[model samples]
Target chain A: MSDVRLSNGSPTLERTDPRLPEHPKPSACKSLFGPVDHEELKKDFNAHLRELEEAAAARWDFDFANDQPLANGRLQWELVEHSSVPDFYSRPPRENGVCSGNNNVDHNGNHHCDGMAQSEETSRADSQMECTEQSSGPRKRSACHDPSAQSKRSHTSPEEVSCPNLSHSAEHTPRKTRRLSALQCVQ
Target chain B: MEDQLLCCEVDSIRRAYQDVNLLNDRVLHTMLKAEENYLPSPNYFKCVQREIVPKMRKILATWMLEVCEEQKCEEEVFPLAMNYLDRFLSVEATRKTRLQLLGATCMFLASKMKETVPLTAEKLCIYTDNSVQPGELLQMELLVLNKLKWDLASVTPHDFIEHFLSKLKICPSTKQILRKHAQTFVALCATDVNFIASPPSMVAAGSVVAAVQGLYLKSQDVSLSSQNLTNFLSQVIRSDPDCLRSCQEQIESLLESSLRQAQQHGGPAESKRVDEEVDLSCTPTDVRDINI
Candidate 1:
């Protein structure tokens, strides 16, 4: 913005700095809504997310917050081998976490709140156990089970009917390749 | 020296060339079809919001515009962020206290959508003066993305500006200046609640017509006159010419009021602006002072 200020009457040569200052304009920096109640805001957010999750679970018959595949879901989820599908489905999240990286990256390599991730991590583990009991009589867990595979369900599913790419990318690669072939298991 | 040269080559402006392919009828038709899906409820202030009001929206929009201008974000970011804000508010009746956080989250998402080097969460938090944490912003971002159903590619008025300008027979430089003025009008409209839920194509047409009238470019082309341009663009967007005329008039009055406010606050310097804008038209090229 300073490069072409000819009307200002300054004749000094300008530096070619392309970047803006690290800090934003001070005029717009002050908070507009006064102090935020972090505790209260957190509560509201959790409740909203829970509602979204429950609606999604009912509509799609899958519990995304818990990563459990519902039996009555219209389209069943069967664990597939990592090599069977694209590497993007099973790839570990980048070290920076997500593509641009903030703190939104979760176990499934998608952006979610820390609270959601915490609850999702615990519940998903429990759901995996529940699925284990149902899918395979008593199969032992394997090392290759890729965990970056949790996808959103229907209704309130973060996955939209309009966006097939997102849902496609949500398919997790099965770690127990030996058992996946024997049984169309839910991971 | 060769290695340094290679590094410098990569550091140039990180935007892609304007895709001429995007300025075609097919794309314009697609945008016309797609734009309605992204509009906020026109009466969201009455139905959806209890704590937030129109006046508060204006304040937040002004601040967001300031930040975008200072940070040199792309023209689309501010309006896109505003779209996100309105969409979220349309669905969720939020408290007045969390409005800034919502505004910041919208900006974060919009910047990521449009900018090559998106605004960082840390810097955005700093702009909030620590009222909201980076983590909170990140969380809010998730909520917003989910609320929006990750439909971030909302057709903005800027999207229609190119197509409208393409159909115009003006010279390239003339089109460029007219585009700037129209974009400023679109940004101004984004701040005002009246233009909400109006089709982006209509807003773009209105802005183009209003800008052409402001620039006094009717002498260059018959199509540039207020009536002819309104008819032409209204047809292009397939709306009633009268509706387009009304939208243009609303924009003109908005510009006039904004200039009047500037004059009241700007003292001697603004008096000069008033003199230039004597016939109720805002300055065409000066974008910095056109705060709404």
Candidate 2:
């Protein structure tokens, strides 16, 4: 009773044996199918990663819609009747709005929605690639560089297209990232 | 010897299964950790939820699409704003402060986190119309973060809406509406801030389904074969029909305003202008759809 100690220099309740209670350890690599072929899945996973990267780079941003900062917390009817509803965003731009002539906001001090800053473009590209790779059909094609498909896809999904952990192996994304996905895209 | 004994006591306190704050209290701290299953103190919740809904409605109403139509704030910034608000109010600070200042601090913290090129203190002052001070906002941000243990990770209604949409094998058009509904619904939840304790995804799914139901789109019936999908969606929308109706009223008003603004600013000639823009980029296959 006088000589009990825990790890980290913390004291432990005195017992006959001070050694840490032993328990069965978990398997180092648990797979859906016992003893999974890591080599096969690894290659497949890598291909998916590359496809996502390429798709992201090729994605575009063409939304010309301008939404004012929400007054209070909701939209006002008066402003809605007077202002044009913004078109949704498209893909990453070749240039930022500051560099593009579209940077000129309306007389009403509206911020430019067409031109995404570089960092946003980068994140969008990353999200785009990830989104395309996650999908299985025609939408999966990287249409960012293909201006023809860009417009068609614009009516599809906006930034919500690039959700984290959307793939079969989505579970592999870090827990931290998955948790952040909870916030979605408010900020 | 005294230092060693003190260290042991501190270690024991840290190792205690129950919270240390539970000792000697009329109200238990355990109750503090209790699920905010109910709304916050009705007074504060009502203040933001009731006032902000109409205000957001006004903003949504007047927005438009244009060649040079400026982007409002980035979508990325919105979550941060919501997070700032949520984290700020999660504490017991409401006992000490008022709602207006709390709401202002949330905006300040969120603007800094979300905006790529954030607004300045002066701009924020103008934005909130001098409701709060930059110094106070900054101080509040730090205080809120500390209260939240700097755990900034948040799940928004948008994220849940996205996941819920993906669960269905729906068309892209439907998906788009779902996306809109999700955003709108999340914004709607802000009006009923008592639901803040619920995950954003759950709130988004719940609100979207409710919005869909209100719009006469029986999303639950969309997947009739999948009872799981139907039941899951049904539960979410069923909780508060009245809140859903109120949200729908807000959205309809906003949409009307947005369309009106588009018409006034966009003009009759705008249709042709957008058509030409669309024609310039639309592919050969899409040509038929464009005409139709």
Candidate 3:
């Protein structure tokens, strides 16, 4: 596990890093409600929602504040973004990074950064604006100097890398259509 | 004109099915592997060593299910919520009193992830009879998210159902029925802690197989041979035959006992009695002791 921390510490983790599979997007597909009478259901659902909203509003009047301290000492509502944390839990050493290193050696020889380069190209195309800034000058020189460091840089930019795979799969019409059919069948 | 449109729709569905078949295998594999880290320790409730028990979890899961059903929330919401609850209990030594609060908070988080219109924090508090405040639920939500390292996309058995069903060569009519029954089995699996031992894909395959068998037993023309089912499931899930069979057996046994219980005590009324019986002995405690 400590080894995972060391490996993920590298700056080059790309979208295609097999270790870090993209977050499973919440499936948009709806459940099969069976032979539900829509008119009856809509009426019931509306009444239920209205009742719930009323009850909730009543609770909100007196119980608005959480007992837990929000942000140090002050009581303020806040949204914390967790995108900065590279997903370290999922990356077992055998599946990605170090293992890919051996594959790099076996497939592309000493230019081990070849696999990283391919993924980086995809990432570059995927996030052109971000890649343009990061892929130029010092970073590229440093990447050339050390293959391991290059892998690190590629692995670290998960947002740039992971987003494309999700969008790519969704944009791919066949998968999208099948998801639609599956959703329809469920209904 | 109708026939041409039908043919085009079938062609599109078939093409999409093929694409998903390829993608589902890779995705399921990655998810199963990643889930190992997120699973709460099996003895998490035991380790907490208070009023918490395995039965309490069952009761809480039932309540969570009812809440989801009442809201018409997505099928994934309840199971995903259970995952959060178990993961939280594993790490935190929670008081028995806060179990429902934990369950509600988990549901709140999961509905946000899986539903089009999530259950509001205020609404979840109302479900708890106003014992908990919205702010507290929100606080617990953040605590759980942080504890889980913001990995809310943990795979549930539902993710694998469509993939497995597509692999089977069944008639279109029965496919809908089979999918529905399979979903019920998945929900059943979520209520029991034992199912956690099996990977989500295996549970899904098992549920589909069991649903087919259950449906077939009622009438005989389904054409679903065990050998064919086993071969297809093994290939698609990339699992050993023995593991799949064991999981199938577990699900079958769970179904049998549940069926027997329902028959003996007349269903929902009895389950409600059991829940009331369990709740009778509880003493309320401050939420601070929840130890998130």
Off by over 4 Å in 1: A1-21, A59-85, A97-163, A166-187, B1-10, B267-292
Model 3 agreement with the true structure over A1-187: per-residue lDDT tens digits: 1112211111111111121122211221111111223354335434533443344224222111111111221111121112322222112222342112222221101122343454343333334322222222121110011111112223233232211232232322221211111110000
- Looking at model 3, residue A65 earns an lDDT score of 16
Q: Could you arrange the candidates by lDDT from highest to lowest?
A: 1, 3, 2
State each model's CA lDDT, in order: 0.68, 0.36, 0.51
Listed in order, each prediction's TM-score against the native is 0.76, 0.35, 0.53
Sort candidate 1 into its docking category: incorrect
Q: Which stretches of candidate 3 lie over 4 Å from their true place?
A: A1-187, B1-24, B48-50, B217-223, B267-292
The DockQ of predicted model 2 stands at 0.01
Per-residue CA lDDT of candidate 2, range A122-169, in tens?
344445434322222222211122122213333244333332223322
Q: What does candidate 1's lDDT look like per residue over B1-292, in tens digits?
A: 7776566645544333456776789988898999989989999999999999999998788777767766767778888999999999999899998999999889988887765567778777777877998777877886887778767888899888888988999987777777878887898899889988898888999999988887778877786778888888998999999999999999989988877776675677444323323322454635324421
> What local lDDT does model 3 show for residue A165?
30
Off by over 4 Å in 2: A1-187, B1-71, B75-83, B94-98, B219-221, B224-230, B234-292
Worst ten in a row by lDDT for model 3 chain B: B279-288
| CAPRI grade of model 3 | incorrect
RMSD of each: 8.6, 30.0, 21.1
Candidate 1, residues A1-187, lDDT tens digits: the string is 2123211111111212344746775555778878999999888877766665666555544555445557565434444334655444344433542223566544222345444454446444554644544442222222221222233323333332222233333332222222222223322
Worst 10 residues of 2 chain B by lDDT: B60-69
For each of the candidates, give the backbone clash count: 2, 52, 12
